[model samples]
Target chain A: MSYFSLEYIAMITGFLLIVLGIWAILTYKNLLKIVIGFSLFDTGINIIIVSIAYVKNSTAPIIDSAVSLKDAVNKIADPVPQALVLTSIVIGLGVTALMLAYVLKLYQDKKTLDIESFTDLKW
Target chain B: MLYTISTLILSLIVLVLAVIAIIHKNITVAIIAMGTVGLFTSVIFLLLAAPDVAMTEAAIGSGLTTVIFFYVLNKIKNHDA
Candidate 1:
Protein backbone atom coordinates (compact mmCIF):
# COMPACT_ATOMS: atom_id res chain seq x y z
CA MET A 1 0.00 0.00 0.00
CA SER A 2 0.93 3.67 -0.05
CA TYR A 3 2.58 5.61 2.76
CA PHE A 4 -0.34 7.92 3.48
CA SER A 5 -2.55 4.88 3.32
CA LEU A 6 -0.82 3.45 6.38
CA GLU A 7 -0.99 6.77 8.16
CA TYR A 8 -4.71 7.10 7.52
CA ILE A 9 -5.29 3.70 9.09
CA ALA A 10 -3.13 4.59 12.05
CA MET A 11 -5.03 7.84 12.61
CA ILE A 12 -8.36 6.07 12.82
CA THR A 13 -7.00 3.44 15.17
CA GLY A 14 -5.44 6.08 17.40
CA PHE A 15 -8.76 7.91 17.60
CA LEU A 16 -10.52 4.73 18.69
CA LEU A 17 -7.93 4.05 21.38
CA ILE A 18 -8.49 7.54 22.80
CA VAL A 19 -12.24 7.04 22.93
CA LEU A 20 -11.76 3.68 24.64
CA GLY A 21 -9.47 5.23 27.23
CA ILE A 22 -12.10 7.82 28.12
CA TRP A 23 -14.78 5.19 28.38
CA ALA A 24 -12.63 3.01 30.64
CA ILE A 25 -12.00 5.91 33.03
CA LEU A 26 -15.57 7.18 33.11
CA THR A 27 -17.55 3.98 33.54
CA TYR A 28 -15.38 1.37 35.24
CA LYS A 29 -15.75 1.48 38.98
CA ASN A 30 -12.71 -0.68 39.65
CA LEU A 31 -9.44 1.12 40.39
CA LEU A 32 -7.60 -1.44 38.32
CA LYS A 33 -9.73 -0.61 35.32
CA ILE A 34 -8.88 3.02 35.77
CA VAL A 35 -5.21 2.14 35.69
CA ILE A 36 -5.80 0.09 32.56
CA GLY A 37 -7.58 3.08 31.06
CA PHE A 38 -4.51 5.19 31.65
CA SER A 39 -2.47 2.58 29.77
CA LEU A 40 -4.98 2.69 26.98
CA PHE A 41 -4.54 6.42 26.79
CA ASP A 42 -0.81 5.92 26.61
CA THR A 43 -1.26 3.47 23.77
CA GLY A 44 -3.29 5.99 21.80
CA ILE A 45 -0.66 8.68 22.22
CA ASN A 46 2.05 6.26 21.06
CA ILE A 47 0.05 5.49 17.96
CA ILE A 48 -0.20 9.17 17.17
CA ILE A 49 3.54 9.59 17.58
CA VAL A 50 4.32 6.69 15.24
CA SER A 51 1.85 7.83 12.61
CA ILE A 52 3.40 11.29 12.63
CA ALA A 53 6.70 9.71 11.63
CA TYR A 54 5.33 8.03 8.54
CA VAL A 55 7.17 8.72 5.28
CA LYS A 56 6.57 7.65 1.70
CA ASN A 57 8.21 4.40 0.54
CA SER A 58 11.19 4.50 2.87
CA THR A 59 13.55 1.84 4.17
CA ALA A 60 15.03 1.33 7.59
CA PRO A 61 17.59 3.84 8.81
CA ILE A 62 20.52 1.63 7.87
CA ILE A 63 23.28 2.58 5.50
CA ASP A 64 23.41 0.50 2.33
CA SER A 65 25.15 0.62 -1.04
CA ALA A 66 21.80 0.61 -2.91
CA VAL A 67 21.12 4.08 -1.57
CA SER A 68 23.57 6.81 -0.64
CA LEU A 69 24.17 7.40 3.06
CA LYS A 70 22.63 10.88 2.78
CA ASP A 71 19.48 9.54 1.07
CA ALA A 72 19.19 6.75 3.62
CA VAL A 73 19.48 9.15 6.51
CA ASN A 74 17.06 11.61 4.93
CA LYS A 75 14.38 8.98 4.25
CA ILE A 76 14.89 7.12 7.50
CA ALA A 77 11.96 6.96 9.93
CA ASP A 78 11.99 9.43 12.77
CA PRO A 79 13.86 8.09 15.79
CA VAL A 80 11.92 10.32 18.15
CA PRO A 81 8.94 7.96 18.39
CA GLN A 82 11.22 5.05 19.12
CA ALA A 83 12.77 6.97 21.97
CA LEU A 84 9.40 8.09 23.30
CA VAL A 85 8.03 4.56 23.22
CA LEU A 86 11.02 3.33 25.18
CA THR A 87 10.39 5.87 27.92
CA SER A 88 6.66 5.29 27.89
CA ILE A 89 7.02 1.52 28.15
CA VAL A 90 9.23 1.83 31.20
CA ILE A 91 6.88 4.33 32.76
CA GLY A 92 3.89 2.16 32.08
CA LEU A 93 5.55 -0.83 33.69
CA GLY A 94 6.52 1.14 36.77
CA VAL A 95 3.07 2.61 37.21
CA THR A 96 1.30 -0.69 36.77
CA ALA A 97 3.54 -2.41 39.28
CA LEU A 98 3.01 0.35 41.80
CA MET A 99 -0.73 0.26 41.30
CA LEU A 100 -0.84 -3.48 41.84
CA ALA A 101 1.18 -3.18 45.01
CA TYR A 102 -1.18 -0.52 46.29
CA VAL A 103 -4.13 -2.69 45.47
CA LEU A 104 -2.65 -5.45 47.59
CA LYS A 105 -2.10 -3.09 50.47
CA LEU A 106 -5.59 -1.75 50.14
CA TYR A 107 -6.95 -5.27 50.27
CA GLN A 108 -4.97 -6.03 53.40
CA ASP A 109 -6.16 -2.90 55.15
CA LYS A 110 -9.79 -2.88 54.11
CA LYS A 111 -10.39 -6.68 53.92
CA THR A 112 -12.25 -6.08 50.68
CA LEU A 113 -11.39 -5.23 47.09
CA ASP A 114 -14.60 -3.45 46.21
CA ILE A 115 -13.78 0.21 45.93
CA GLU A 116 -17.30 1.04 47.03
CA SER A 117 -16.62 -0.84 50.27
CA PHE A 118 -13.84 1.51 51.27
CA THR A 119 -16.19 4.19 52.47
CA ASP A 120 -14.30 4.68 55.74
CA LEU A 121 -11.65 6.96 54.22
CA LYS A 122 -14.15 9.59 53.15
CA TRP A 123 -14.96 12.41 55.51
CA MET B 1 -10.27 4.17 -0.50
CA LEU B 2 -10.33 0.52 0.44
CA TYR B 3 -7.73 1.06 3.13
CA THR B 4 -9.70 3.95 4.57
CA ILE B 5 -12.86 1.89 4.71
CA SER B 6 -11.11 -0.98 6.46
CA THR B 7 -9.60 1.37 8.98
CA LEU B 8 -13.00 2.88 9.68
CA ILE B 9 -14.47 -0.55 10.28
CA LEU B 10 -11.69 -1.51 12.69
CA SER B 11 -12.08 1.76 14.52
CA LEU B 12 -15.81 1.23 14.87
CA ILE B 13 -15.19 -2.22 16.33
CA VAL B 14 -12.79 -0.73 18.85
CA LEU B 15 -15.39 1.86 19.86
CA VAL B 16 -18.08 -0.74 20.35
CA LEU B 17 -15.81 -2.88 22.53
CA ALA B 18 -14.87 0.12 24.62
CA VAL B 19 -18.50 0.97 25.24
CA ILE B 20 -19.17 -2.60 26.27
CA ALA B 21 -16.25 -2.56 28.68
CA ILE B 22 -17.49 0.61 30.34
CA ILE B 23 -21.13 -0.40 30.69
CA HIS B 24 -20.66 -3.98 31.74
CA LYS B 25 -21.56 -4.62 35.36
CA ASN B 26 -19.19 -7.52 35.76
CA ILE B 27 -15.72 -6.26 36.61
CA THR B 28 -14.13 -9.34 35.09
CA VAL B 29 -15.77 -8.64 31.76
CA ALA B 30 -14.69 -5.05 31.95
CA ILE B 31 -11.09 -6.03 32.55
CA ILE B 32 -11.17 -8.48 29.67
CA ALA B 33 -12.56 -5.76 27.46
CA MET B 34 -9.72 -3.53 28.52
CA GLY B 35 -7.33 -6.23 27.32
CA THR B 36 -9.12 -6.28 24.00
CA VAL B 37 -8.73 -2.54 23.85
CA GLY B 38 -5.02 -2.97 24.38
CA LEU B 39 -4.83 -5.54 21.61
CA PHE B 40 -6.51 -3.21 19.14
CA THR B 41 -4.44 -0.28 20.28
CA SER B 42 -1.26 -2.25 19.61
CA VAL B 43 -2.54 -3.06 16.17
CA ILE B 44 -3.04 0.63 15.61
CA PHE B 45 0.50 1.31 16.77
CA LEU B 46 1.79 -1.19 14.25
CA LEU B 47 -0.21 0.48 11.51
CA LEU B 48 1.30 3.80 12.55
CA ALA B 49 4.81 2.48 11.82
CA ALA B 50 5.75 2.28 15.48
CA PRO B 51 6.70 -1.36 15.84
CA ASP B 52 8.54 -0.53 19.02
CA VAL B 53 5.44 0.92 20.60
CA ALA B 54 3.38 -1.96 19.32
CA MET B 55 5.79 -4.41 20.91
CA THR B 56 5.68 -2.62 24.22
CA GLU B 57 1.89 -2.36 24.19
CA ALA B 58 1.49 -5.97 23.26
CA ALA B 59 3.90 -7.13 25.96
CA ILE B 60 3.00 -4.85 28.86
CA GLY B 61 -0.45 -3.56 28.03
CA SER B 62 -2.07 -6.81 27.01
CA GLY B 63 0.24 -9.27 28.71
CA LEU B 64 1.52 -8.26 32.14
CA THR B 65 -1.32 -5.92 33.00
CA THR B 66 -3.92 -8.58 32.44
CA VAL B 67 -2.04 -11.03 34.59
CA ILE B 68 -1.75 -8.51 37.41
CA PHE B 69 -5.42 -7.63 37.25
CA PHE B 70 -6.39 -11.27 37.40
CA TYR B 71 -4.08 -11.95 40.31
CA VAL B 72 -5.52 -9.06 42.29
CA LEU B 73 -9.03 -10.13 41.42
CA ASN B 74 -8.34 -13.62 42.64
CA LYS B 75 -6.90 -12.36 45.90
CA ILE B 76 -10.00 -10.33 46.50
CA LYS B 77 -12.26 -13.14 45.41
CA ASN B 78 -10.85 -15.79 47.72
CA HIS B 79 -10.69 -13.43 50.67
CA ASP B 80 -14.15 -11.98 50.57
CA ALA B 81 -14.11 -12.17 54.36
Candidate 2:
Protein backbone atom coordinates (compact mmCIF):
# COMPACT_ATOMS: atom_id res chain seq x y z
CA MET A 1 0.00 0.00 0.00
CA SER A 2 1.11 3.55 -0.72
CA TYR A 3 2.39 5.33 2.39
CA PHE A 4 0.78 8.68 1.72
CA SER A 5 -2.73 7.80 0.72
CA LEU A 6 -4.77 10.65 2.17
CA GLU A 7 -6.92 8.56 4.45
CA TYR A 8 -4.02 6.56 5.76
CA ILE A 9 -1.97 9.67 6.46
CA ALA A 10 -4.79 11.40 8.29
CA MET A 11 -5.72 8.39 10.36
CA ILE A 12 -2.12 7.82 11.28
CA THR A 13 -1.55 11.43 12.24
CA GLY A 14 -4.70 11.52 14.34
CA PHE A 15 -3.77 8.29 16.08
CA LEU A 16 -0.26 9.55 16.73
CA LEU A 17 -1.66 12.70 18.33
CA ILE A 18 -3.92 10.60 20.53
CA VAL A 19 -0.95 8.54 21.68
CA LEU A 20 1.13 11.63 22.41
CA GLY A 21 -1.73 13.21 24.29
CA ILE A 22 -2.18 10.15 26.44
CA TRP A 23 1.54 10.09 27.11
CA ALA A 24 1.48 13.71 28.28
CA ILE A 25 -1.50 13.17 30.51
CA LEU A 26 0.02 10.07 32.08
CA THR A 27 3.54 11.40 32.58
CA TYR A 28 2.96 15.00 33.59
CA LYS A 29 2.55 16.03 37.21
CA ASN A 30 1.27 19.53 36.49
CA LEU A 31 -2.48 20.09 36.15
CA LEU A 32 -1.88 22.64 33.41
CA LYS A 33 0.19 20.17 31.44
CA ILE A 34 -2.58 17.62 31.68
CA VAL A 35 -5.01 20.24 30.36
CA ILE A 36 -2.70 20.89 27.45
CA GLY A 37 -2.63 17.17 26.80
CA PHE A 38 -6.41 17.00 26.92
CA SER A 39 -6.57 19.79 24.39
CA LEU A 40 -4.18 17.87 22.17
CA PHE A 41 -6.41 14.84 22.38
CA ASP A 42 -9.43 17.00 21.53
CA THR A 43 -7.66 18.46 18.52
CA GLY A 44 -6.65 14.98 17.38
CA ILE A 45 -10.20 13.65 17.58
CA ASN A 46 -11.41 16.70 15.68
CA ILE A 47 -8.81 16.09 12.99
CA ILE A 48 -9.86 12.48 12.64
CA ILE A 49 -13.51 13.45 12.36
CA VAL A 50 -12.80 16.11 9.75
CA SER A 51 -10.54 13.72 7.86
CA ILE A 52 -13.32 11.16 7.71
CA ALA A 53 -15.52 13.74 6.03
CA TYR A 54 -12.89 14.54 3.42
CA VAL A 55 -12.96 13.43 -0.17
CA LYS A 56 -9.68 13.92 -1.97
CA ASN A 57 -10.06 16.76 -4.49
CA SER A 58 -13.54 17.57 -3.26
CA THR A 59 -14.56 21.20 -2.93
CA ALA A 60 -15.87 22.97 0.16
CA PRO A 61 -19.53 22.44 1.04
CA ILE A 62 -20.61 25.95 0.11
CA ILE A 63 -23.27 26.02 -2.58
CA ASP A 64 -22.06 27.95 -5.61
CA SER A 65 -23.46 29.17 -8.87
CA ALA A 66 -20.58 27.47 -10.69
CA VAL A 67 -21.78 24.00 -9.84
CA SER A 68 -25.27 22.74 -10.48
CA LEU A 69 -27.07 20.77 -7.78
CA LYS A 70 -27.11 17.66 -9.95
CA ASP A 71 -23.33 17.47 -10.22
CA ALA A 72 -22.67 19.11 -6.84
CA VAL A 73 -23.39 15.90 -4.96
CA ASN A 74 -20.03 14.49 -5.93
CA LYS A 75 -18.10 17.71 -5.54
CA ILE A 76 -18.71 18.91 -2.00
CA ALA A 77 -17.38 17.60 1.31
CA ASP A 78 -19.70 16.35 4.04
CA PRO A 79 -21.43 18.99 6.15
CA VAL A 80 -22.38 16.93 9.16
CA PRO A 81 -18.92 16.49 10.58
CA GLN A 82 -18.14 20.14 10.02
CA ALA A 83 -21.26 21.12 11.93
CA LEU A 84 -20.54 18.71 14.74
CA VAL A 85 -16.95 19.91 14.93
CA LEU A 86 -18.15 23.50 15.25
CA THR A 87 -20.13 22.72 18.39
CA SER A 88 -17.39 20.46 19.64
CA ILE A 89 -14.77 23.12 19.29
CA VAL A 90 -16.83 25.61 21.24
CA ILE A 91 -17.46 22.96 23.87
CA GLY A 92 -13.76 22.26 24.10
CA LEU A 93 -13.07 25.90 24.78
CA GLY A 94 -15.70 25.95 27.48
CA VAL A 95 -14.34 22.83 29.10
CA THR A 96 -10.82 24.24 29.07
CA ALA A 97 -12.03 27.42 30.66
CA LEU A 98 -13.74 25.48 33.41
CA MET A 99 -10.66 23.40 34.04
CA LEU A 100 -8.46 26.46 34.27
CA ALA A 101 -10.88 28.04 36.67
CA TYR A 102 -10.74 24.89 38.73
CA VAL A 103 -6.98 25.09 38.64
CA LEU A 104 -7.17 28.63 39.91
CA LYS A 105 -9.40 27.61 42.77
CA LEU A 106 -7.28 24.60 43.61
CA TYR A 107 -4.11 26.65 43.64
CA GLN A 108 -5.73 29.21 45.90
CA ASP A 109 -6.67 26.57 48.42
CA LYS A 110 -3.70 24.20 48.20
CA LYS A 111 -0.85 26.47 47.01
CA THR A 112 0.31 23.83 44.58
CA LEU A 113 -0.35 22.49 41.06
CA ASP A 114 0.84 18.93 41.44
CA ILE A 115 -1.74 16.27 40.66
CA GLU A 116 -0.19 13.85 43.16
CA SER A 117 -0.75 16.30 45.98
CA PHE A 118 -4.49 16.21 45.33
CA THR A 119 -4.81 12.59 46.43
CA ASP A 120 -6.49 13.76 49.60
CA LEU A 121 -9.71 14.06 47.59
CA LYS A 122 -9.11 11.02 45.38
CA TRP A 123 -10.01 8.07 47.56
CA MET B 1 1.97 12.67 -6.16
CA LEU B 2 2.47 16.19 -4.87
CA TYR B 3 -0.69 16.09 -2.77
CA THR B 4 0.40 12.95 -1.02
CA ILE B 5 3.84 14.38 -0.35
CA SER B 6 2.42 17.59 1.06
CA THR B 7 0.07 15.72 3.35
CA LEU B 8 2.90 13.59 4.58
CA ILE B 9 5.06 16.60 5.29
CA LEU B 10 2.33 18.55 7.06
CA SER B 11 1.39 15.59 9.22
CA LEU B 12 5.00 15.06 10.18
CA ILE B 13 5.39 18.68 11.19
CA VAL B 14 2.19 18.47 13.21
CA LEU B 15 3.31 15.35 15.04
CA VAL B 16 6.67 16.93 15.85
CA LEU B 17 5.01 20.06 17.20
CA ALA B 18 2.72 17.95 19.37
CA VAL B 19 5.65 16.12 20.88
CA ILE B 20 7.39 19.39 21.61
CA ALA B 21 4.29 20.79 23.22
CA ILE B 22 4.15 17.79 25.51
CA ILE B 23 7.81 17.60 26.43
CA HIS B 24 8.89 21.21 26.64
CA LYS B 25 10.12 22.44 30.04
CA ASN B 26 8.43 25.80 30.20
CA ILE B 27 4.65 25.88 30.46
CA THR B 28 4.52 29.00 28.31
CA VAL B 29 6.61 27.36 25.59
CA ALA B 30 4.52 24.21 25.69
CA ILE B 31 1.31 26.21 25.37
CA ILE B 32 2.77 28.10 22.43
CA ALA B 33 3.58 24.81 20.76
CA MET B 34 0.02 23.69 21.42
CA GLY B 35 -1.29 26.78 19.64
CA THR B 36 0.97 26.05 16.71
CA VAL B 37 -0.40 22.54 16.57
CA GLY B 38 -3.91 23.96 16.47
CA LEU B 39 -3.02 26.32 13.66
CA PHE B 40 -1.45 23.53 11.64
CA THR B 41 -4.38 21.22 12.31
CA SER B 42 -6.73 23.88 10.99
CA VAL B 43 -4.67 24.07 7.84
CA ILE B 44 -4.87 20.33 7.57
CA PHE B 45 -8.63 20.59 8.02
CA LEU B 46 -8.83 23.08 5.19
CA LEU B 47 -6.76 20.80 2.98
CA LEU B 48 -9.16 18.03 3.92
CA ALA B 49 -11.98 20.22 2.50
CA ALA B 50 -13.63 20.98 5.82
CA PRO B 51 -13.40 24.76 5.80
CA ASP B 52 -16.00 25.24 8.51
CA VAL B 53 -14.22 22.93 10.87
CA ALA B 54 -10.99 24.65 9.97
CA MET B 55 -12.33 28.04 10.96
CA THR B 56 -13.79 26.86 14.21
CA GLU B 57 -10.62 25.05 15.12
CA ALA B 58 -8.61 28.13 14.36
CA ALA B 59 -10.76 30.37 16.47
CA ILE B 60 -11.28 28.15 19.46
CA GLY B 61 -8.17 25.99 19.53
CA SER B 62 -5.41 28.35 18.44
CA GLY B 63 -6.84 31.76 19.22
CA LEU B 64 -9.13 31.56 22.20
CA THR B 65 -7.47 28.77 24.11
CA THR B 66 -4.00 30.27 23.86
CA VAL B 67 -5.22 33.61 25.09
CA ILE B 68 -7.13 32.03 27.91
CA PHE B 69 -4.18 29.92 28.95
CA PHE B 70 -1.89 32.90 29.03
CA TYR B 71 -4.41 34.93 30.94
CA VAL B 72 -4.65 32.27 33.59
CA LEU B 73 -0.91 31.88 33.66
CA ASN B 74 -0.48 35.57 34.26
CA LYS B 75 -3.08 35.55 36.95
CA ILE B 76 -1.37 32.70 38.71
CA LYS B 77 2.01 34.37 38.40
CA ASN B 78 0.63 37.56 39.88
CA HIS B 79 -1.07 35.66 42.65
CA ASP B 80 2.06 33.82 43.63
CA ALA B 81 4.40 36.73 43.15
Candidate 3:
Protein backbone atom coordinates (compact mmCIF):
# COMPACT_ATOMS: atom_id res chain seq x y z
CA MET A 1 0.00 0.00 0.00
CA SER A 2 0.99 3.60 -0.47
CA TYR A 3 2.48 5.45 2.48
CA PHE A 4 -0.15 8.22 2.44
CA SER A 5 -3.28 6.77 0.87
CA LEU A 6 -6.67 8.09 1.92
CA GLU A 7 -8.00 4.74 3.12
CA TYR A 8 -4.81 3.95 5.01
CA ILE A 9 -4.77 7.28 6.79
CA ALA A 10 -8.41 6.96 7.85
CA MET A 11 -8.09 3.35 8.96
CA ILE A 12 -4.91 4.04 10.89
CA THR A 13 -6.53 6.98 12.63
CA GLY A 14 -9.46 4.79 13.51
CA PHE A 15 -7.17 2.16 14.94
CA LEU A 16 -5.31 4.78 16.95
CA LEU A 17 -8.57 6.10 18.33
CA ILE A 18 -9.53 2.61 19.40
CA VAL A 19 -6.24 2.17 21.19
CA LEU A 20 -6.57 5.54 22.88
CA GLY A 21 -10.08 4.70 24.00
CA ILE A 22 -8.96 1.41 25.46
CA TRP A 23 -6.13 3.11 27.29
CA ALA A 24 -8.48 5.71 28.72
CA ILE A 25 -10.94 3.10 29.84
CA LEU A 26 -8.29 1.02 31.56
CA THR A 27 -6.51 3.92 33.25
CA TYR A 28 -9.29 6.29 34.23
CA LYS A 29 -10.82 5.83 37.66
CA ASN A 30 -13.76 8.12 36.99
CA LEU A 31 -16.95 6.58 35.56
CA LEU A 32 -17.57 9.59 33.30
CA LYS A 33 -14.14 9.29 31.71
CA ILE A 34 -14.78 5.64 31.07
CA VAL A 35 -17.96 6.66 29.26
CA ILE A 36 -15.91 9.03 27.12
CA GLY A 37 -13.62 6.14 26.29
CA PHE A 38 -16.58 4.11 25.13
CA SER A 39 -17.66 6.96 22.89
CA LEU A 40 -14.22 7.14 21.34
CA PHE A 41 -14.29 3.42 20.72
CA ASP A 42 -17.64 3.76 19.01
CA THR A 43 -16.38 6.59 16.79
CA GLY A 44 -13.30 4.57 15.86
CA ILE A 45 -15.38 1.61 14.82
CA ASN A 46 -17.56 3.80 12.62
CA ILE A 47 -14.55 5.39 10.94
CA ILE A 48 -13.03 2.01 10.25
CA ILE A 49 -16.24 0.76 8.74
CA VAL A 50 -16.49 3.79 6.46
CA SER A 51 -12.85 3.54 5.44
CA ILE A 52 -13.34 -0.07 4.47
CA ALA A 53 -16.10 0.94 2.10
CA TYR A 54 -14.12 3.53 0.18
CA VAL A 55 -13.30 2.76 -3.47
CA LYS A 56 -10.51 4.40 -5.46
CA ASN A 57 -11.69 7.44 -7.46
CA SER A 58 -15.29 6.77 -6.58
CA THR A 59 -17.92 9.33 -5.70
CA ALA A 60 -20.80 8.88 -3.27
CA PRO A 61 -23.40 6.15 -3.70
CA ILE A 62 -26.05 8.66 -4.57
CA ILE A 63 -27.45 8.43 -8.14
CA ASP A 64 -27.62 12.11 -9.03
CA SER A 65 -26.10 14.16 -11.85
CA ALA A 66 -22.64 13.35 -10.61
CA VAL A 67 -23.21 9.59 -10.91
CA SER A 68 -25.51 8.17 -13.55
CA LEU A 69 -27.44 4.88 -13.33
CA LYS A 70 -25.31 2.83 -15.75
CA ASP A 71 -21.86 3.96 -14.59
CA ALA A 72 -22.89 4.29 -10.94
CA VAL A 73 -21.85 0.76 -10.09
CA ASN A 74 -18.13 1.32 -10.59
CA LYS A 75 -18.01 5.03 -9.89
CA ILE A 76 -19.56 5.01 -6.44
CA ALA A 77 -18.38 3.91 -3.03
CA ASP A 78 -20.14 1.11 -1.15
CA PRO A 79 -23.45 2.14 0.38
CA VAL A 80 -23.94 -0.82 2.68
CA PRO A 81 -21.32 0.24 5.19
CA GLN A 82 -22.65 3.77 5.18
CA ALA A 83 -26.08 2.46 6.15
CA LEU A 84 -24.54 0.25 8.80
CA VAL A 85 -22.58 3.16 10.24
CA LEU A 86 -25.74 5.19 10.50
CA THR A 87 -27.39 2.52 12.60
CA SER A 88 -24.23 2.19 14.67
CA ILE A 89 -24.18 5.91 15.37
CA VAL A 90 -27.74 5.85 16.69
CA ILE A 91 -26.97 2.80 18.80
CA GLY A 92 -23.85 4.45 20.17
CA LEU A 93 -25.83 7.48 21.23
CA GLY A 94 -28.35 5.32 23.06
CA VAL A 95 -25.60 3.37 24.76
CA THR A 96 -23.87 6.56 25.84
CA ALA A 97 -27.07 7.99 27.31
CA LEU A 98 -27.81 4.77 29.16
CA MET A 99 -24.30 4.67 30.57
CA LEU A 100 -24.57 8.25 31.77
CA ALA A 101 -27.85 7.44 33.51
CA TYR A 102 -26.25 4.47 35.23
CA VAL A 103 -23.35 6.64 36.29
CA LEU A 104 -25.72 9.19 37.71
CA LYS A 105 -27.51 6.55 39.75
CA LEU A 106 -24.25 5.20 41.05
CA TYR A 107 -23.16 8.69 42.05
CA GLN A 108 -26.45 9.32 43.83
CA ASP A 109 -26.08 6.13 45.81
CA LYS A 110 -22.48 6.64 46.93
CA LYS A 111 -21.76 10.30 46.14
CA THR A 112 -18.71 9.23 44.17
CA LEU A 113 -17.76 8.74 40.51
CA ASP A 114 -14.76 6.53 41.19
CA ILE A 115 -14.95 3.00 39.86
CA GLU A 116 -12.99 1.69 42.82
CA SER A 117 -15.65 3.01 45.16
CA PHE A 118 -18.29 0.79 43.57
CA THR A 119 -16.99 -2.53 44.75
CA ASP A 120 -20.16 -3.99 46.13
CA LEU A 121 -20.06 -6.88 43.68
CA LYS A 122 -16.31 -7.25 43.54
CA TRP A 123 -14.98 -10.67 44.35
CA MET B 1 -2.85 13.78 -3.81
CA LEU B 2 -4.78 16.65 -2.22
CA TYR B 3 -7.27 14.26 -0.63
CA THR B 4 -4.50 12.26 0.96
CA ILE B 5 -2.82 15.31 2.44
CA SER B 6 -6.06 16.74 3.82
CA THR B 7 -7.05 13.44 5.31
CA LEU B 8 -3.66 13.18 6.96
CA ILE B 9 -3.97 16.61 8.50
CA LEU B 10 -7.52 16.04 9.73
CA SER B 11 -6.62 12.68 11.18
CA LEU B 12 -3.72 14.21 13.06
CA ILE B 13 -5.98 16.89 14.49
CA VAL B 14 -8.49 14.26 15.57
CA LEU B 15 -5.86 12.15 17.30
CA VAL B 16 -4.50 15.15 19.12
CA LEU B 17 -7.95 16.23 20.30
CA ALA B 18 -8.66 12.70 21.49
CA VAL B 19 -5.47 12.68 23.51
CA ILE B 20 -6.40 15.98 25.07
CA ALA B 21 -9.87 14.67 25.87
CA ILE B 22 -8.37 11.69 27.64
CA ILE B 23 -5.53 13.46 29.48
CA HIS B 24 -6.96 16.89 30.34
CA LYS B 25 -7.48 17.47 34.05
CA ASN B 26 -10.60 19.55 33.57
CA ILE B 27 -13.62 17.47 32.63
CA THR B 28 -15.24 20.35 30.78
CA VAL B 29 -12.20 20.85 28.59
CA ALA B 30 -12.09 17.16 27.94
CA ILE B 31 -15.74 17.15 26.89
CA ILE B 32 -15.21 20.06 24.52
CA ALA B 33 -12.18 18.38 22.98
CA MET B 34 -14.15 15.23 22.47
CA GLY B 35 -16.90 17.20 20.74
CA THR B 36 -14.36 18.83 18.46
CA VAL B 37 -13.09 15.39 17.59
CA GLY B 38 -16.59 14.48 16.45
CA LEU B 39 -16.84 17.64 14.38
CA PHE B 40 -13.63 16.85 12.56
CA THR B 41 -14.62 13.24 12.12
CA SER B 42 -17.72 14.43 10.30
CA VAL B 43 -15.58 16.57 8.05
CA ILE B 44 -13.49 13.51 7.31
CA PHE B 45 -16.67 11.68 6.45
CA LEU B 46 -17.52 14.41 3.99
CA LEU B 47 -14.16 13.98 2.36
CA LEU B 48 -14.84 10.25 2.18
CA ALA B 49 -17.94 10.91 0.04
CA ALA B 50 -20.38 10.04 2.78
CA PRO B 51 -22.31 13.26 3.09
CA ASP B 52 -25.26 11.67 4.88
CA VAL B 53 -23.01 10.14 7.46
CA ALA B 54 -21.21 13.45 7.83
CA MET B 55 -24.44 15.29 8.58
CA THR B 56 -25.54 12.73 11.12
CA GLU B 57 -22.21 12.79 12.88
CA ALA B 58 -22.20 16.56 13.02
CA ALA B 59 -25.71 16.82 14.45
CA ILE B 60 -25.81 13.82 16.75
CA GLY B 61 -22.18 13.20 17.52
CA SER B 62 -20.95 16.76 17.95
CA GLY B 63 -24.13 18.64 18.79
CA LEU B 64 -26.51 16.43 20.72
CA THR B 65 -23.89 14.29 22.43
CA THR B 66 -22.02 17.32 23.72
CA VAL B 67 -25.23 18.86 25.00
CA ILE B 68 -26.15 15.66 26.77
CA PHE B 69 -22.75 15.42 28.42
CA PHE B 70 -22.93 18.99 29.60
CA TYR B 71 -26.45 18.45 30.92
CA VAL B 72 -25.37 15.47 32.95
CA LEU B 73 -22.38 17.36 34.24
CA ASN B 74 -24.61 20.21 35.32
CA LYS B 75 -26.92 17.85 37.13
CA ILE B 76 -24.02 16.35 38.99
CA LYS B 77 -22.74 19.78 39.99
CA ASN B 78 -26.17 20.87 41.17
CA HIS B 79 -26.46 17.73 43.25
CA ASP B 80 -23.15 18.51 44.87
CA ALA B 81 -24.37 21.98 45.91
Question: Pick by lDDT: which candidate is best?
Answer: 3
Write the number of the candidate with greater lDDT, choosing between 1 and 3.
Answer: 3
DockQ of each: 0.44, 0.82, 0.82
Q: Tell me the TM-score of each prediction against the true structure.
A: 0.77, 0.95, 0.98
Worst 10 residues of 1 chain A by lDDT: A54-63
lDDT at residue B51 of model 1 (Cα atoms)? 67
Candidate 3: residue A26 lDDT (0-100): 100
lDDT of 2: 0.88
TM-score of 3: 0.98
Q: Where does the lowest 10-residue lDDT sum fall in candidate 2 chain B? A: B1-10
Clashes of each: 0, 0, 0
User: B59 in model 3: Cα distance from truth in Å?
Assistant: 0.7
lDDT of 1 by residue, A5-87 (tens): 76766766676677778877777667777766776777677677777776654444445676577677666677676677768
Query: Which structure is stronger by lDDT: 1 or 2?
Result: 2
TM-score of chain A of each: 0.80, 0.91, 0.97
Among all windows of 10 consecutive residues in model 2 chain A, the one with the lowest summed lDDT is A1-10
- Once fitted onto the true fold, the runs of candidate 3 whose alpha carbons sit more than 4 angstroms away are none
Given candidate 3, what's the lDDT at residue A32? 88
Whole-model Cα lDDT of every candidate shown, in order = 0.71, 0.88, 0.93
For the record, the alpha-carbon RMSD of candidate 3 to the native fold, in angstroms, is 0.8
